[model samples]
Target: MTESETVRLGARIRAYRTMRRLTVRGLAGLAGASPSFVSQLERGRTSASVGMLRRISGALGITVADLFNEDDGAGHRVVRRLERPELPAGPGTRKYLISQRPLQNLEVYAGEFEPGASTGGEPYSHGDSQEILLVLRGRVTVWLGPPAEAVANTLAPGDSVEYRTSIPHRVVNDGDGTAEVLWVVSPPTPL
Candidate 1:
């Protein structure tokens, strides 16, 4: 891998590891490699074989594509004219993407929620990854974990939170006004 590619891959690996709260030793054991090897991989000091990459992806619960995709720079020029696929989660929720395709290190999205809007499903857990949410407008109530710990966080604008995704989590708009959040998912989520 080139230096840039290695750096991007390393960033993705590190993001996933932190999201999962997995130590180098833990991931190394899961990948059947040494801690040193895992560290080298995360630092981009060494390249992993196809088999090894697959093993690592499997251990991380993500696809190989999620780890190697390149940024196309499609929707970053201007804020108003960015064409992004609006993923329909449920009624009253809208999702806008800052990228048309998934990149190696980060996934950016603009999300809007109507009053009483919710993620509209059971709390879901991704692979080894962390999520950051920045509320641009209104207030939102986020619940984390299968036990559903109510997060008493309310954001009017320019407020954000980053958390591990290993536990189940959901976001809801419990206030009267619509909520807008800029969400970034690290290590990318498989399309």
Candidate 2:
């Protein structure tokens, strides 16, 4: 892979890894690789083969296409609109369009949250699903369970987080500036 492609792949790997809430060591073990290998792959220092990527994707319960999809202008793509049926969680938030319509068995959105905003504060569940969140700006706190795994991790423009939808998870904007996230959910909700 070229430098740019390597970087993109690394970003995707990191995104999926975070989405699954798997540590480097954990993913490496699951993928039959070493921790250093996973770390290097996530940093773009190494390139992953199709086999490796397949294993990783399988472990994450996602299809290979999910890791390599480009924006193809499918369904109804929206820009900055706030009148749609936005998921009820987090005040002072907006969800822009990343996909045209919520078809194709998947959905993606550009989420913007003002400072001190949050999502799904009342402990909700979404059946059996998964969510991937890439932090495009500022910092946010993620709570992932009733036990409440407080992820105070700060994400810069290129950081991300992913987790199973079976467990209740919520996000809160904890930075001084607004937080922007690219959120992708699989198995489109019946809305």
Candidate 3:
């Protein structure tokens, strides 16, 4: 491969390794290679032979062709507005999935909430991950914790909050108009 192609290939390998939650040493052990070699390959400081790539790809539980997919696992991609998929949501609410499918370490959603619309009747949890909710327009209330003693924060445009997804949470539109927001989450949760 050319130098640029080699760099991109290294990036794909690194992305796949991370998605599989494998350490460099762990992957090297599985691939029958040295940890230093894997590290060098991932950092674009060195190139791997076809055989080495095969071993690495096998260790990652993917075919060599998958490594060359256009998605590049975690590389640059663009999702046009028209291509965003609509998601099933609670009453008076609409959500668009802004992140690409076969999700990587992160996922995003664009939400539109009509007056009094809420995520659910009660708080909900999403495994163990980090999440950020950013209000883009109108006003909304975010509730975190059990229903009995939930903490509610009313947010306006430009406001954002970060929290752990393990905590039960819900969001509601508090204004008379529609509320627009973005939800950014890491280590994506299943839809």
Candidate 4:
């Protein structure tokens, strides 16, 4: 990354960390990093690898893409399709941040997944908010709760589901082809 970009990244990290009310040490512990490392990274004195950035973003309940965007969800009423920032995902999976940063009441995302791609191997919860997932193409399976006692629902085009964000959940593309989905969350929460 360029010098300016690195500084901006550090600023974003600091902003999110502060907004989450986490100290440098707390963030380091959650991200499996050292406090000094996080401090330096936030101060723009150092750079982080992709792996480190992913871990930190995960710990902060945000997407890596959020670290690069500067939009604060103010004054902009529309987000152009070609200008949407993308979140790093697993192979064959694409996640886009359709909503601006420092989310107000709502957060949105659009995703495309190749067959067999999934959000993750395990379910994860963000906070106490409401979420709606709508399938726009192909098929997907939504898993709620831990793997041991999870509820799975297969969704086709136009299918939608509403659930609490506090409940651990995962989404998988279980179709024969690529699947597209839209996620809308109210009272925006991290992750």
The clash count of every prediction, one per candidate, is: 0, 8, 0, 0
Q: What's the residue-level lDDT of 59 in candidate 1?
A: 70
Worst 10 residues of 3 by lDDT: 68-77
Candidate lDDT scores, in order, read 0.76, 0.71, 0.85, 0.88
Best by the TM-score measure? 3
RMSD (Cα, Å) of candidate 3? 7.1
Judging by lDDT against the true structure, name the best candidate.
4
Q: Summarize candidate 1's per-residue lDDT along 18-79 as a digit string, tens digits.
A: 65557899878877889999898898888889899888877765667867855444556454
lDDT measured at residue 16 in model 3 versus the true structure, 0 to 100: 75
TM, every model:
0.59, 0.51, 0.65, 0.62
Compared with the true structure, what per-residue lDDT tens digits does model 3 show for residues 1-191?
Answer: 78888788888889877875678998899899999999999988898888988888877766778777866455567989888899999999999989775566788999999999999788999655689999999999999888888899989999998888889999999899999999998876533
After TM-score superposition, what is the CA distance of residue 46 in candidate 4 from its true location, in Å?
32
Per-residue lDDT tens digits for candidate 2, residues 1-191, read 68988878788777767655568998798889999999998899998889998887776656667667655445565555554455544568776656544134567777888988877465555635577889988888777676455444456778877777677777778888999888787754323
Native-to-model Cα distance after best TM-score fit, residue 140 in candidate 1, in Å: 0.4
What is the overall TM-score of model 4 with all chains considered together? 0.62
Greater-TM-score candidate between 2 and 4? 4
